[model samples]
Target: MLEDLAFPIERLGQAVTDVQLLFEKYKYENGIIFGHAKDGNLHFVISQGFFTKEDIDRFEHFNQDLFDLVLNKYDGALKAEHSTGRAVSAFVEKEWGPAAYRVMKRLKNVIDPANLLNPGIIITEDKQAHVHDLKVMPVVEEEVDKCIECGYCEQSCPSRDLTLTPRRRIVIRRAIKRMEDTGDRAGRKALLKDYRYDGMETGAVDGMCGELPGEH
Candidate 1:
């Protein structure tokens, strides 16, 4: 929670504690700490001051200590909703424990035998995989390719007047395309869950996008 990080930081300035204790108490401050309270996992943004090798080492130790407090003490996760991607993949085992991690490895091996799909994510060789160099490709070729260069959807978008457009639809199309290309059924299912149907409905005929039965 956002308060969890900030409350501690504010307390530290007033509380009588050594620099080490202060460092230990508020290390999560160096990283962005926010997450869905309903889910119980926090997201973090480590300072870019951690760009150097020495800084990275220090941050890693600091993060390990913070995880020991936040995760082990509180029984929370290092990652809840987000995938064990490039950033937090190395911490999966630390969070999940060896038995659970082995099960995950087995599942990954069964599902992605070749490991060509997002390898080093969620599973990796060294335990110190840092979040770096993650790239995603477009997926929905049919919808994206059907643009016709007219920008009709943009013009017709209900939110366009409010300075917003259906950008998520484009993202969905790309996700669908990736699933089709990589055969990632789980990802496809997750992507499709975000879709909502809009337009008029009539008995035995839905007026979706102004289409009525056989009308062209």
Candidate 2:
């Protein structure tokens, strides 16, 4: 689980300590916390598994605890540094209160009344939408699993314009692996038709990705 959070500068010291302690309570000792204190902005990343009901329940409880602390204790922003997509859309009202949320809905109605622009993203009626589509990252292969899909290698790939970049190659590979695992033969065949050219034939295959920094 990763989140970008913000709090008042005065509470920076306490907030950081509290968050670390909260993770410890959850037994997530590997939780990483980092960001800038100048803006009281912190970004934390923690590895978690949702493969079991116990894992899901634990995450839900931890999420509630963190949100209560941020919203009630410190009055902080749940989404401080990134797009308030479906992940935080359900909490918009909790963060801004009902009155401001209503104004936002009215403004959205005036602007995109048709609801064609990124619907169920910034504002959503489904409270559990975020939990519904939890992504399970299957290990495709040891070499490709390490890619975070950050797209940093795309700019440097020699065949980026001609074919799939390093990131896209790995993405398609993973998708194909998922489809195969799920027995989606038709979908796999359709994707493989394009994958032959975009993912395989046009590659320079010069180990440029390996030379780039980090696991990717």
Instruction: List, residue by residue over 1-216, the lDDT tens digit for candidate 2.
Output: 668899999999999999999999999887999988899999898777788988877777787788888999999999877778766777888899999999999999999999988998877887765676777766776788777675788899889888889888788777877888899989888887887677666778755223221114
Candidate 1 lDDT tens digits, 1-216? 111221133333332133235364545455343544343433444433444666566656765665565455455555555445565677778877899999999998999899988888779876666634423434334434333222456766665554324443554555566686789888766655543332222111212223211123
- TM-score to native of every candidate shown: 0.46, 0.84
Best by lDDT: 2
**Model 2 segments more than 4 A misplaced:** 150-160, 204-216
Collision pairs in model 2: none
Candidate 2 is scored at a TM of 0.84
